[model samples]
Target: MKPERARSLQWLLVRRLILLQAGMLLFFIVLLIVVLSVVKPRLMIDNEAAVTAVTGAVDRDKDGKLIVHDTDELTQFRAEHPKVWYIIHDTTGQTARVGMAPPDYDRDLGSLLSSVDHASIGFAGKRDGKEMRPEAFVQKVDTKAGPVQVVTSTFHSRSDSEGFDISITAIVDMARKPDGTADWPRVLPGLLASLGIVLLPIILAMGVTTLVTTPAVVRRSLTGLIGTANQAAHIDFDTRAMQLPVKNVPQEVVPLVNAFNQALSRLAQGIDSHNRFLTDAAHELRTPIAILRTRAELLTDEPETLRLRQDIERLSHLAQQLLDHQSLDRPNEHRRVVDLAEFAGRVAADLAPLAIEAGYDFAFEPPDGKVEVEVNALQIEQLLANIVRNAIEHGGGKGTITVLVDRAGGLEVHDEGPGIPVEEHKNVFEPFYRVHPHSHGAGLGLNLARQIAQLHGGSIAILNGPWQGARVRVHLPLHRQTA
Candidate 1:
């Protein structure tokens, strides 16, 4: 099964913020409608249709004065509300009146125009308590002739049964004709269509702003965590008790890093204790093995005694190999630059006697000039000794063994005996792996040599030599910086 993809915190936060912003926008729209229904602003007017109807019907005559041209829209307004009365004043001081006022409202066009100086519309100083605002306001409109002032008065019901000011929605419902039933689809589309067009830009800008900025905010908030993660990549067994520093870490993440550090400390201590026990055990067995070997050598030349000596010697060799493996793990020793050819020759001379005693001729071939490398001298010597000893033990007890030191900071050892098999080449470097079953030597020599070579930033390879025996090659870096 495929794993589910992980969601990014940055994008997740952006999406949630956008959703919250949309919700807030919706809530405010509802609240505005509720407040408009309850507490009406004194200036809110439902006069767009009247303004458009009057302005669109007037144009310039031969005298450049406003005159009605009798359009269909004006006819419709008159048909919808039979009580509509309007007084229009063009820029040229020309005026026109269409319908008559009621008998009780005996104001002329001039008096009605002058009465607009104050906000309240009243015949004397007071109106009947039932009506607050009749459609009596001075509105300036744009016409083809120029600017014109229009004053209108009409009575439809501006208030509901509870005397709360009616909303534009209720006013529209009241204006529906004939049977007094409202057709909302006919009224709402033109007025409410612009609401979505106006809101579209705001929603897009909000979502885009969230998408662009949330990742940066999340990244800055977790900068310390990112640094800690980079440091965690370098952790390994060689680091021992290394712990992540938590001083600059965020407060919410401190506990997790602290717990990880504690776990690393415990693991390091456990490995250290295990290594210490092995080294101590190897040290303790050396004395007992030597004593038993000495006693076995002193026994008479019987077959049982000879077998006992060989077993004791083998036991002693195994313990020494264990000690060597443990000791090479510590790389704190200081290293110095030395000539590679001179060092290899010295190591070959020291191991030549052991090869001669095993009935093999030993030879050392040095490079033409000096090849230099930075290495710990004692450990390099032990590595060379282990490789030559492997050749002596497993080279079928016959012809010449050659140690060639390369000028390019490497060494090659070749022996003239039955060669190692091609398939077993890689397995020969594994610990406790022996090529010939009856061989009396411990099988950790090549494994230890390979470890030491890698510690110095080098490698080892086993191959078939030209003279019918296994060839072992070692390569080291040329003058590496010491740690």
Candidate 2:
């Protein structure tokens, strides 16, 4: 089965935060509009705003007469509010009236300008079947030209146009009923435009902020978990003492890490128990196998007796290989520097008799110079013995077995047997894996050799030889190191 595609935790977290922020902002905008719609909305002008608009438009004509000129604010106001009434009265007693109003306000503006500086001018009216009074802002201001009185009034649906907020004008204008009929086509567009004006910049700012900050926050928050995952990648039975650290981990993930640590502890305990059982069994079997070999030797030289002795000997060899393989995992106290060329020559000389007994010629070739290495003497001796035994047992029982050493800290054993198939090269080193399933050898030899070689910081591999045979090479990393 193929694995699922991996999703980035940081990317997922950032998307969630951005979506959460967007949801909140939209909710706030709707809530704001709802609250405003429920309140008593007004779009009235204040005395200060009224005076400033009026003063800017006040100027003298060519004949030196005070007049009111149309400015941008006044032009927009008049265009949207045709029913509005405004009267600009100057110090020269010339009054300019722009829109319709009750006769009382027009008459009072010119004659009562001296007495009234500010007043709420209005008339009695009925709205929503209730009695009400309209309101207009009247104020007098000093300008560059002279003093002028500005009376400004606006009409929407009611007279309660208090100076609380100004956006109410958009709502009123959208449904403006000057002919007692609402302008239905403009309502939706006007509402949408008002909302856009209020929300566009907020959306833009929040989008920028979310993009810039979310990934960094998520990555920093998960630093401890990432580190723990890195440590988990290299875990094995050899590193049973290793533990994952929880420093800077998030509070929510601490329990998960604790559970993982507890599980690892249980696994390490089981592995240790299994290894101890194997070591104990191998040691207990050695003495009985030795006794069995002695008794079997007493009756050998007959055909059936010879077969029995061979079986007993194979069992004894298997038991000893088990002991040797387990011993490689034990702590070493005899590691020292030895000349590999001289060392390989001595071990090969001792194994030559076995080669000759198997009907094969044996030879040892030493390097040109001293090829020294630091290793446990007993372990390397076992590793070399295993490789030579494998060659003698399977070297077609003919041809030559050659051991060669080089100055580069490499030792090779070449035999005139059919070379290992290319596909089985790597699998050959796995424990208990044999090319022929029923072979006499128990198959622990090469695997034990591999383990011992690795314990000394070296590696072993099968290479193609010139004689169409197996060339087994072992490379120790350094020739010699200071003790």
Give all TM-scores, in the order shown.
0.67, 0.70
Candidate 2 CA-lDDT value: 0.78
| Model 1 global lDDT (CA atoms, 0 to 1) | 0.78
Encode model 2's per-residue lDDT on 1-483: one tens digit a residue. 999999987777767776787789889878877888799554445433555556777777888777678889867766755556667777667777666765545665445645687666545665457744345678887865688777776643244454453432232454766887767676878777877887778777887787788788878888888898899888875686578888867989989988888899998888778878998998899899889889988884899998888888888778889889777666766988898888889999999999998899999999787878998988999999999988876788888999999888888999988778888888889999898898777888889889988888999999854567888999886643522
Off by over 4 Å in 1: 1-5, 31-196, 220-223, 247-251, 434-442, 464-467, 480-483
Checking candidate 1 for backbone clashes, the offending pairs are: none
**Pick by TM-score: which candidate is best?**
2
Error of 1 at 365 (Å): 0.9
Collision count for each candidate, in order: 0, 0
Tens-place lDDT digits, model 1, residues 1-483: 999999887888999999999889878987997998799765534344565577788787897766777789888987875666666776567776666644333344564554343232444234565444454556677787777777665543244123553434323332365788666667678657656786778988999998888889889988988888888888987785778988778898999999999999999889888999999999999999988988888899999997898798778878988998898867548898999899889888888998998899999999898888998888888788888888887888999899998867778889887878888999989998888877876779999989989888899999754568889999988874421
Query: Cα miss at 477, model 1 (Å)?
Result: 2.2
Give the C-alpha miss distance for residue 153 in model 1, angstroms: 20
lDDT of each: 0.78, 0.78
Candidate 2 clashes between residue pairs 3 or more apart in a chain or in different chains: none
